[model samples]
Target: MAEWINVKDIADGAKFYAGAAIRIMPTPCGLEEGNFIPENGLVYLISDNASDKSYFNCVCLSAGEEGNVICRLERKGNYVLGSEIKRMFESELQEAFISKSIEIAVI
Candidate 1:
């Protein structure tokens, strides 16, 4: 199995991106979220560097109270989701890059 590093170990220059929200269509089976990217458009996740991920042209969530739950884009200095990890690092070196945790820096 591949080694998974904690969110903290991610590099500072690492790039992270998110997928766009797609309107769900009601069907007999169930509603399905569209693919990460639409046809003839940029893919949500790009494995080019496989180390630093980049997110662009996507609707970023904001800090707002819609109801009881608050859903927003990742802010700086917070742990990122597993989906934000673009590359895997050596297990031994993970600790050196991070101490407590890491976050998604949107720029």
Candidate 2:
């Protein structure tokens, strides 16, 4: 498996290669490898070292009275709206839907 490193952990002036990918997650929560993109996170294909990488998307959940549900949404290109993840989290009651424990390291 390709190593998945947290962007926050990357040192300044770190190097990258063409065709490499960056996982654009709405939140800082980690994602497991081999899962669908947007289902957990969005993947940005690096066009080159010159490709700009920045995203400010967010997830809006329905009110608690609505059972913390996510409103239906349309897919945006290759990315799944964060609403779907919120729905998965709510449906699973957050039990291992994301992760049950915090990870101090990335692989």
Candidate number of the best TM-score: 2
Clashes of each: 2, 0
Off by over 4 Å in 2: 28-39, 48-107
Error of 2 at 21 (Å): 0.8
**Tens digits of per-residue lDDT for model 1 on 14-96?**
54433322111123222233332222221111112222333222222222311221123242333333333323312221221
Q: Rate the local accuracy (lDDT) of all candidates.
A: 0.28, 0.32
Using Cα atoms with residue i matched to residue i, what is each candidate's TM-score against the true structure? Answer: 0.19, 0.33
Output the lDDT of residue 76, model 1. 32
